[model samples]
Target chain A: ANDDCSKMLLNRCSGCIAVRKSLNSRNISKLLHSCPHRCDHHKIIVEAEDKYKSEVRKSFICNKKILLTPRRRQLRIES
Target chain B: MFRGQRGWFCGSVGQDLRQLWVAEGGTVCDVQAADFLFSCDASHPDTLRIYQSLDYIEDNATVFHAYYLYAVANAEMKTSVALGHFILPPASVQKEIRRKVGGFIWEQDKYFQIEKHDEL
Candidate 1:
């Protein structure tokens, strides 16, 4: 379980990590705890179109890519 | 007891229910009306009553927070500043003591420390 995501593997690519608002970054550990809404390999994201029926939990599938664009609050500092 | 230029008074105790027992040096009392902007006392029935009837600092510089003691885990969850003044409970374990002034940091005696390369 790492916080910096220095060695995260996403689709054989090494860098792209799922950065969710509740998750901050994809570095899951057994004893790791941040938001109660976060769990290993799964997240509950509301589908944007229908705000009412998007209550189901959704898993995020991501790939590692060299994103040259700047991101907001991208620096994930874990507790 | 007059506070000098940049001195801060600090001391706290843990109660049976993890309540922080504050002594005289704490802010709730002894602050001159001109010392603070606002203050808040949380739901400690007996404690709040005693601190209220007493005269308090009336200026805009006064502020108090009486939160569920253990409910607040880390202050960093509430801060986004690189360098600034804030009356916070305590920064996270990952954050190092970077600076100090005017208020009491939960732990650490020295005023400031930088983060990124720090340890608890």
Candidate 2:
């Protein structure tokens, strides 16, 4: 029943346990009510770093996709 | 050794992986000069190519984790294991990583599963 997850290594707490079990047993709307930690998890997963936060615009994510794509290189000559 | 161990984070779990490493007292560094590599999967040959370009060997890189972002979190996809050497993180650090890097949720049953490398 400790709520201090900051120090705890594993999320083996009862809250985390209930959330894991709910994933396969409920709907999003109902799940939201059943667990608030869902929001917390989302925050951790999608959270961005401060350094790049300012660069994240609506089109920034699109740019990320492009950057992630495989790139091909070719030799160039400037004679 | 752990204090300043530099590491690189690649694949879908880049941000999360970087955060986890930093939280664990290890330095999450850029790929250009990294002592360790954390890749989500090995599906992309480019990942391995990058490692090679960095002059790093297989023993220095580990690709054992995959993440699935659900609609609830605004991601439109789920991921599966790819062909490669998949090594789980050290058992000692498993609990810490899981606790901090909360994972995807299954709407059908409404349980939150902390994303970890579930396969060998």
Tens digits of per-residue lDDT, candidate 2, B2-119, equal: 3565655555454544555565466766654554455554444545444333122212233233232211232232212111112223322333434675322221223234545324
Candidate 1 per-residue C-alpha lDDT over B1-120 given as tens digits, one digit per residue, 9 for 90 to 100: 112211111222123111221221223333232232111222333323322321211111212222212212223432221111122211221122222111222122222222221121
| Local distance difference test, candidate 1 | 0.21
- Give each model's whole-structure lDDT: 0.21, 0.35
Please provide, for model 1 over A1-79, each residue's C-alpha lDDT reduced to its tens digit, 9 standing for 90 to 100: 2321212122211111322222110122111223344322112111111121111111111222223243232442322
Model 2 earns a TM-score of: 0.30
After superposition, the stretches of candidate 2 with alpha carbons farther than 4 Å from their true spots are A1-79, B51-120
Score residue B114 of candidate 2 by CA lDDT.
50
For candidate 1, the per-residue lDDT at B51 reads 28
Worst 10 residues of 1 chain B by lDDT: B53-62
What CAPRI-style quality would you assign to candidate 2? incorrect
